[model samples]
Target: MNESLNELLYRSFDTTLSDEEQQRLDEGLKQSEGLRQEYDRLKTMRRIMAEQPQPDFMPGFADRVLQRLEDGGDASGDAQLFFEALWLSFRRMGTVALLLLIAAISYNIGSSDNVSLRSAFNIPETTMEEIIEPDFYQELESLR
Candidate 1:
């Protein structure tokens, strides 16, 4: 009647109980049939576990990883292709910009002598000083 069957199971299976506690548990077993049945069930479970062993798994998990690499499933290759397409678009835009800049420069060279009667706002050559550097204009400036 005084027996804690849970405490007895913990003591019998886990080996953490004191001698006085074990003696008290033994006395409790004779006093109560319900406590004795619970204790017997716990003991039977522990005995069955000691008889059967657990299974272990195989160790070649790295083989699957190596097989994936050999099959060209790398994410870096996909990212590289995306970046290459982006770079090609940027290069095409750069070529178009360079062609427009060259055409503007050629037009200015060819249309220099066309004089008009209208007195509109005239943009000074110094405004384009950096676009056409001083050293580049030095030969033409000396002839003036």
Candidate 2:
């Protein structure tokens, strides 16, 4: 019921009370019956929570939550489900990109017999004379 009593009472639950603080809190507890009941309630709640098993969630759950928040507003029901599904599938998007890269490399290699990187990408070897020929190439076959 004292001004500092409630603060000291709550602090006792979470912190190691110093000799002076512990003395003050003990004095407060002696004077107030309600304070004693609150202390008991908090202690019992902590014990009950400690005995319960921890919970788990599906993967990417946190990411989807943050993504929804980043989009600016809260969503519920069907919209929430749709956003969660989108975040969950994001990992597969990386796989999709990788497959495209491999396909491009394969295409580049398959197009040339030489199999070198430049040939795979179809970059041709050229001379300054060949590049300088604005009107005509050094060879007619070069057109192909």
Candidate 3:
């Protein structure tokens, strides 16, 4: 029901409960059915654990883990080399693609018979009539 009661109950299983803690735990178990049930469960668990054999690890567990890490370090270096080669391949492909695109555009511009690249983008040529329009002179005279 409360932390103090739970601690007392656990301590009791461990045979470490003080007289005051034991009294408190006994009063709590008497007052609350939940506390009594939890206490029984914990006591059974403690007894089951005590009855079971302790676990044993193989020797050199730490050494085996270190060995695995050392082995994995080589794999990391190989992965880095693989990624670097992939990036270099992509860069070379990009440069070749750009060169091919430029060559294709140059060939298209040079092979065209109708309009040259310069003429296609050039401003329209002005006629003498447009340059010497009477309305333009009138506007200029008005501005002056």
Best by lDDT: 2
Candidate 1's residue-wise lDDT over 1-144, tens digit each?
443655665677667668887777777778788787887787788799888887655777688668778878675677889999999999999999989876766666556664432211223444545666788777667788
Look at candidate 2 and tell me the lDDT of residue 15.
88
The collision pairs in model 1 are none
Q: What is the alpha-carbon lDDT for the whole of candidate 2?
A: 0.81
In model 1, the runs with Cα more than 4 Å from the true position are: 1-5, 59-144
Ranking by lDDT: 2, 3, 1
Give, for candidate 2, the lowest lDDT window spanning 10 residues.
132-141
Residue 119 lDDT in model 3? 41
Give the TM-score (vs. native) of candidate 3. Answer: 0.35
**Candidate 2 accuracy as TM-score:** 0.37
- lDDT of residue 71 for candidate 3: 86
Leading candidate by TM-score: 2
Comparing 1 with 2 on TM-score, the higher-scoring candidate is 2
lDDT of 1 at 84: 92
Of 2 and 3, the candidate ahead on TM-score is 2
The candidates, ranked best first by TM-score, are 2, 1, 3
